[model samples]
Target: MNGNRFGRLFQLTTYGESHGDAMGVVVSGCPAGVELSTEDIQRDLDRRKPGQSMITTSRGEPDEVRIQSGLQDGYTTGTPLGMLIENKDARSGKYEPFVTAPRPSHGDFTYSAKFGTRNWGGGGRSSARETVNWVAAGAVAKRVLEASDHDVRIKAHVSQIGDVEAPEVTFEEMLEHSEENEVRCAHPETAEEMREVADQHQTAGDSIGGAIYFECRGVPRGLGAPRFDGVPARLAQAMYSIPAVNDFEYGIGREARTTTGGEYNEDWEFDGNGDPTPVGNDHGGVQGGITTGQPIYGEVTWHPPVSIPKSQRTVDWETREEKEIQVVGRHDPVLPPRAVPVVEAMLYCTVLDFMLLGGRINPDRIDDRPGEYDTDYHPRSPENVDD
Candidate 1:
């Protein structure tokens, strides 16, 4: 499709469908000589893969990633990094009925209206399964950022599910506890409550909406431009691109609505190192569309998944009759728990893109040294082999 690509400088173009043979991504513009491996990419994929817990989808796909190109001796080659993940567990029999009937609140109707036909199996290209490729690409971006001179860290956790909300926590707390539970919430007590609520919804054959809290630390200042290319604007595009994400807010977000300028505006001061800094972070690390050299914190709200086991009515375009259908296929009862990794992946890609665009990182190589080919990561000629 036309919109599969994302980012500038460091670009990601994804291909394949949910029920197709495989899902793949091409990550272009990655600098050479960065250490990368199938294990590095698979770690993130396992987090985003289905069947991780009782709250997520039960699909048994292992989500094993195969690196097809763009590496030499475990380092990137500064070319398109091609990776593939097979869809071994995609069951299409359950989706056949919806080909003509169209699932309510799904892309089925819209895709058909626009494209005149679609691969109705497992919602085809419009499925959340498409995000698998995004996580794969983000893994590559994560490695790139890790190899850079800057220390960039990105993390996200389930902040709310239905009515259960986690208390505000420190970045350290999020790092320490977010991945310890199946719900992926930073607070243990709140995570239990969220799990209970998710169970209730699943028992009722319904779904519930939730929110994710994300933070980006160590992003240098002056990485974004004003107006259309602003940091917040680009972040919104990235966060909203994830399916089911209904809203995005950064830096005190909606609370600014009732806040006076005096109460909301952060005063500037000099840090111990004689560097200008904001006294408070009400702007969520962006001031006037550029980064403020502080932690970028925000929340993204997700609508309940449209698919459910509960009966729903839809009109069959071909039969000219209303049909009641129950989405009995495997699906998630709640999304944020598994979405944590996906959110982090996207944040990694976005931050690295800004770094490259701002000239903070080298576009050709992580070492930032041009016209020099003999590097430690480069392979050596075989010592004893004779041609």
Candidate 2:
């Protein structure tokens, strides 16, 4: 109910629940006069909307967006921009059983304890559905960043679906391939395999978890607040807000913990232009809580959807008795592909806030850089590409 706002200078506050009639966001502190419209927000929403692929939930929500205010003639008015998306396909009845029996691996039990009651339908505020607002706000933030001539772009893709994964591709390549498939993976072969696995899991009444890799381009140095708003902390905060995100890390994540400093620390050097250049991409673009101006990259891992058609044991909070619960309602068999754009939106928001803090660019006017950076990231196909 509280703490929905993110960022200091360019702030965004999101509200509404999954089954609520509508979800929306209010963005404030944005500079006046940047090009924007409901279509811009709707474009991203369409990517995150359910039923886009066979691997995702079958919910039929169009996730249509409507901009209530904050712009004139397709540009920001410098006031708080308000936007909302109606939830057209909610079936609150699917959550009737959870009135007493909470779903495991979800916030229901804890929310019940803390709030003493909950909407239960579509997991209420805890639902991944809430992130639609983030995407909406992010669309505006992205425009703000773009207007500043920052020459930055954010993108995400399904890197791994259970055991199937694509080969590591460059940031530019990933952007090229992400939107090509429902799984939002660039590699055709791997996306197919991942889709097959998702289908199998759905058939078995199960769900699968996977990893999402994100890349940030053209982010100038000195964007973080240090010690607190450090790049990692900000990115982590935004990433964790996505429901089902169970783990996060950059530059090897847990793998780094297993190595010695000698093996882990990235050695620095100077490029021919005398600018500091990372000897390797090991650090993933952040050191000492600030950007190195390289591609800021990292990943978010989503746990398998906790709700499954197969019955599972849980306790009836009121009865204090153990019982089997078959989670009903629409649920994703796999969330990686659809999550790609959502991650991009969050990354966009994070970078926009960082850029604002760094003063590298301002809204209303942006520098002219014709595709300063080109992304070459491509997803690997599990069926053909080898590790």
Candidate 3:
């Protein structure tokens, strides 16, 4: 309950259960005068919503977003942006079998132990369904960054599904082709392979783990602090917050383990504009805990979804007897495809928070001019001739 909020200056507080009335979020500290609409948030929600394809959950929630507050005309008001998404297809009956038995590798046991009682319906608040709020808030963050002077762009793609891995792709390829396939991998051939893998798992009543590759471009330098507050540290926290995300790594990532220091360390040279630049991007944009004005890229790995049709053993806490449970429900066989947007959203929120903290973008308003009411982003009064 206390950990629902995220970010420092640009904060997001979420509320709701997976099978409850609706999921909602209140985004605070967003600058006023940035153009935003429910459609903008809905676009990202559509990507993360359940029942997207054969590989994803079969639940039929529309995930349509409703903007409840914090806007005047069509722009943000610098107040808490309240948004809501109702759950239309929540079938709590499917989860009743595990209410006391608890599913394997799930938070069911821990939640019950900690809270004494829980919603116990669709995993309650621990569900990835909660990320709907994140994608909503991240849409706002993305719009804020776009409307600002910074040209920050965040993109993520499904890089691996089970044992099938995609070939390395450029940012341009991600933009052009990631969404073209159901797997959301940038490489079309690999995406087909990933899809086939997911289908195999789905047919077997099992689930598979996968990884997502994310990149953030146009993020300014000096947007992060040292040690605990490093950009990489915060990003890791963001990525790990997503359910099932077991691993996070940036820069050369695991490759740095075997790489020699001489080969891993990037040499600095003057750019054509005379600014110091690294000859290569093995560091993935951050050096010494601060951004180096280069692209920040990384991968987030998720464990297989615990909820599957396969029978798993667990104990019924009340009966004190063992039980065999089939977590049969609408569930995704692979996670990376749906997770791509979530990764991008978290990156947008994290990057925008650092931008505001670093004074690279205005915290109060996108225009950066305080007490000046008559800006282009603001609504204009009706002309006198309108009478």
Candidate 4:
């Protein structure tokens, strides 16, 4: 019930459950007078909504967003932004059998032990269903990020689906080809292969998992906090809250064990203009807990959806007796393709918060608005930057 809030200055707190009438987020601390609309948030929500492709869940959630407040005349009002999404296609009965017998690889058993009860419908608060709020909030964060006086942009792609690796592509290639594939991968050929893998697993009543790669560009240096908010720590903490995320890695992440310091170290030097330049980004984007102003790249790995249609053994909550039940619920055969946006959202919130903390986002105040403050304050807007 607690611990729903995320970020320091750009905080997001969510409410409601998977099978509840609705789930929503309360986004606070967004600067005043930024352009925003339901369509902006809905665009990101559409990507995360269930039933997008054969590889994802078939829940058929309309996921229509309702902006309860925080915007007036298509611009932010500098108040708490309330966004809601109704659960139109929830069929709690599909999970009736799971009420007593928890599903494998699910939060049911653990949730019960921790909270003394579980919603049991689509895994309740622990469900991937909760991520919709993050996506909605991320949409707003995207705006906040854009308002900054920086050229930063965040994007993610499905780098791997099970054992099928997506063909390597340049960042530009990833941007150009990512939307062309149903799997949201950057390479067309590899996306087809990943889809085939998903089909195979779905037909077999099994599941598969993969990793999502993300790239953050144009981030200004000095955004990282020394300890509690270290770049890696903040990113990893946000990612770990996502359901079924198994592992996290950044540049040279988990790949430096065999090399010496000289081999894996990201060299540092000066550019022709005498500005610091990273020779190579073996440290991802952060060096010594701060941004190197390079394209920060990393990945978060997901395990296969635990709620396979096939019967799996579990325990009776009341009696602790072994039980087997077919988890006849809609689920994603592969997660990375759908998770791409989520990675971007988390990064947006993380980076935007740090930026705000560092005074990088200088927003405007509306004139003649009863609560509007000084209207003369203005900082560089990212949209005006030469990316």
Candidate 5:
């Protein structure tokens, strides 16, 4: 019920549940006078909306974003911006069985243990549906950041599905090709293979896991605040909030553990003015928690959809008796495609927050002008923050 809010200066709070009347968000601290409207936010929601393709859940919610406050004349008013998306596709009948028999790999049991009861319909707050609000709020943050002359961009694609691996593609190719398929994979050949894999699992009444890679470009040389607010830490925290996400790592994350120290260390280069730039971008753009003006990259592993039609065994929370459970509901056979925009929004929100934390970006001053960013936020001291 608590802790749904994120960010320091430009913050947001999400409310409602998956099967509730609606799910919505209240975004605060955004500078007024920026060009915005329901369309700007709806564009991202359309990408995140469920039932968009055969790969995602069959639930067809319009995912229409309604801006109720904080804007006048198509601009922010510097007040809390509230928006809502109704849940038209919710069906509680399928979840009736889960009232007593908790679904494995889901928060049903933990939620019951922590709270006396839960909204069993569609996993409630624990559902991936909760991420819709994030996508919406992050769209707002992205717009605010764009107005400041900062061109932070996030790209995510399905890197792996079960055992299938997508071939490496350039960021430009990814932008062009990822959305062309239901799998949202950068590689056309591998996306076909991934679809075949998902179909195989669905036919067998099982689910498959996949890995998603996100690349952040155009981030400043220094952002991320230090102590507990490192970029990687915040990235992990935001991503972990999504259901079915089991693992995360940055560039050379586990790979570095296998290499020797000298092999893993990134060599440095100097600009004409003696500024440091790594000869190789092996660090993924961060050193000591601060960005180094290189691309920031990382990956998140998404566990297969937990609510398969196959029957599974679980203990009854009420009677503590073992029983069979069949998870039946509107769910995605593969969720990677729908998750891409959400990932992009979150990365933008994180980097934009760090940018504000490092300097004073008056929301009121941001506009359509280019190269108008206030440089006071660029971190001059590496020790102050983590990238």
Candidate 6:
């Protein structure tokens, strides 16, 4: 619970449970006077909502966002932004059987072991349902980034489902074709195949895992710090927080194990603007923990939903006896496709917060003809502030 907060400057603290009255987020450090509305955040929540597709959970929660506080006349108030989404269709009775019997590959055991108690209703804080706040918070982060001078754009798509991989696509292609399919894969042929795979798994009462690729363009160089707060470190930390996520890789990632340094090195060259640009993104747009003014790309893998219909063995908390369970709740047959926006949202928070921590970027002044950011907030250094 202590680690529920994320980011250093543009921070978010989420509360509520899977079957709680409402799940919400408190966003802090947002500058005053940025265009914001419930509609802006609701769109992203709709994308994260359940029952959107047959492959996803059939829970009928509308996931409509409500801005509780921190906005005045459609702009941030430089105060904590409060937002919430009510749990309209949680069906806690469906989880009654799980009160004593923990599901396999779920946080039921770990959460109980750590806290001495746990909410058995729909896995409580351990549920993907909690990401409504993340997507909502990410929606705010996107506005912060959009308010800045830089034209940073973030996009993500399902690149792989089960053993099936989508054809490689560019960032623009991802934007164009991701929503064309229910699975949210950019490759039309592969998206069809992924849907078919999900159908097959659904018929068999099994679940499958897959990976998603995320790309962020226009990420200004020098966004992250060296050592502890490196871009990779922050990105990994943000990503691993999502439920069912099992792995995080950037650039060539694990592929580099087979690639020699000589082959991996992408020589730099000057562009039309004389900015140093890498001929290739083999480094995934980062070097030495800093953005290289290139498109930052990475991939995240989510394990299959743990609550499949097939019977699985688990231990009883009270009886200390082994038992079998056929998890009957609604769940996603494939998770990575739905994960695309979540990835984009987390990436936005990480980068936006890093920018805030690094320097002052006034969204209003970013449009100045001179192309200079406003320094209303001097850097939070000892020399800039008085005791």
lDDT of candidate 3 over 1-387, digit per residue (tens): 599999999999999999999999999999998988888998999999988899989899999888999998898889899999999999999888888898999999999999898998899999999999999999999999989988899999999999998889999999999999888999999988889999998999988999999899999887799999999999999999999999999988999999998999888999898999999999999998999999999999999988888877899989999988788778888888998989999999999999989998888887843355655553355552345
- Compared with the true structure, what per-residue lDDT tens digits does model 2 show for residues 172-242? 77868777877777787888888888889999999999999888888887668678889999899988888
Candidate 4 accuracy as TM-score: 0.92
- Supply the global lDDT for candidate 5: 0.83
Model 5 lDDT per residue over 35-96, tens place:
78788999999999887766677898999989999988787778899999898988988888
Per-candidate TM equals: 0.95, 0.91, 0.95, 0.92, 0.92, 0.92
Clashes of each: 0, 17, 0, 1, 8, 0
Best of the two (1, 2) by TM-score:
1
> What lDDT would candidate 4 get against the real structure?
0.85
lDDT of 4 at 84: 91
lDDT of 2 at 5: 96
Alpha carbon lDDT at 97, candidate 5 = 76
Residue-by-residue lDDT tens digits, candidate 1, 270-317: 999899999989999999999989999999999998899999899999
Over the stretch 1-387, how does candidate 6's per-residue lDDT look in tens digits? 688899988899999999989999999988776788889898888888888888888889999989989887777778899998999987888787778788888888888889988887888998888898999999999987787777989999999988899878988899999988889999999988889998999899998999999999988888787888889999999999998899999998999999998999888799999988889989887899988888889899988877899988988979999998889978888898778888889999998888888784762223332333467757787777878
Worst 10-residue lDDT window, candidate 3: 377-386
Q: Which candidate is the best by lDDT?
A: 1
Alpha carbon deviation, residue 164, candidate 4 (Å): 0.8
Q: Please write out the lDDT profile of model 4 over residues 267-300, one tens digit for every residue.
A: 6799788998989888888888888887789888
Displacement of the residue 268 alpha carbon in candidate 5, Å: 2.1
Alpha carbon lDDT of residue 67, candidate 5? 93
Q: Better model by TM-score, 1 or 6?
A: 1
